[model samples]
Target: MLLHMFFPSKCVTCGSFGKVLCVSCKNSIKPVTQDSCIVCYRNSINGQTHEICKKTSFIDNALAIIKYTGAGRDWIGVIKYKRAYSTISEVVSIFPQSWIQKFKKITQYYTNALIVPIPLHKQREKARGFNQSKKIAKEFSKITNIPTSCVLLRVINTPQQAKQPTKNTRKENIKGAFILKQGQVVKNKTIILIDDLYTSGCTAQEAAKILKIAGAKTVLLFTLAHGKV
Candidate 1:
């Protein structure tokens, strides 16, 4: 077929072009869940949201698609750390149709919601030549017909959350790192936070807190992969 002639249909992970991600690799990745705080979506493994998250009043809900390990980590690392843009489409193509169905179902709960991606510091963004979160948001928007806003501003750069050794350190590292752009109108509207990975979730929680403070009705989080917190 003409489709097979030009594209070669390789796997995203191992370059097996006939299919995107091979079945073996696909089976290797799995989803995980923890008792998450209703406010911050931090793994409430011990119990509910603590005083800190309650103080910030962060996101209302959060969900992640795959556990951030094994094949999941490899996919994220290859795309994010290695800057493999073309891999996104192939990787994206492999998502179960269930995700799209779920996305459509839950998103209907918030009509006319604006999708926002966590922002990157200008210097890092410039150096990387792209914001992976924004790229993912844009791609999701394209499929869902949702509008995306890159209004969340990272006024100052912080150490990457992945490198932070502890949850407490991650919470501190991203504190005061993000601010809603002035004149942005999110008041009374719902927002969906899109990102590539969710580890400690401090970054999304902090960003959502800022949005809520600015009068957003709700901020929900979604990521392609997650790790136990």
Candidate 2:
């Protein structure tokens, strides 16, 4: 295979041959499975389930590929800041496809969802030259054939959540931060909210709430990683 000749098929993090993520590193980024609450994906961290993630919640479901630290953190940082777009293919190829397939089995109610990337404000986008979420969504769409809608826009700029420390501050900071663009594309459509990471789950939750307000039938969140919250 000529393609195989040029690409060594080495692990992105460790430069080992045979796979994009060597089996050892892949095992390191495993998701926590200690009987977590389905809503917040938190495993009773506060001695009681958080009030926000009560059953029959606003946003339908949230799924993340790996816990965001170690190799996962390194990969996300490289992809976002170091222009390692090739790693996107490597990461996506190594994604837990079984987790996704199983989630679809449970959330069959949202059979015809459209993927929507949370948008960046125009100024920030211009500064960064591209939105990473948009790039992820584009690649996801290519692989899955799910339509991606830029129907939501961040009309106002806010302080970056990565810089903010407190969870409450993160939620408050993004309140009234995004707006549905002047288009009828999302109405009556089941929507999949895509993002690079899930910390505190505030951003994805807020985006899902906004899309629901805009008449999206359902909103599900998907992210590449979930950091400690």
CA shift of 56, model 1, Å: 6.8
Candidate 2 residues lying further than 4 Å off, grouped into runs, are: 1-28, 31-39, 43-57, 103-108
Candidate 1 lDDT, tens digit per residue, 156-218?
Answer: 889888889998999999999989888888899889899998777789888988888888887
For model 1, the stretches where C-alpha displacement exceeds 4 angstroms are 1-27, 31-57
Q: Model 2: which ten-residue window has the lowest total lDDT?
A: 42-51
For residues 1-229, write the lDDT of model 2, one tens digit per residue.
Answer: 7666444376667878876557787666656343244355667531123467645454666666667888888677755654455566566776567655544554455666788898888998887767888888876676566788888888769888888788889989889888888855677888878888877777877787788787888777667776766
- Relative to the true structure, candidate 1 reaches a TM of 0.80
Candidate 2 clashes between residue pairs 3 or more apart in a chain or in different chains: none
TM-score of each model, paired residue for residue: 0.80, 0.77
Residue 134, candidate 1: alpha-carbon lDDT: 86
Native-vs-model 2 lDDT?
0.70
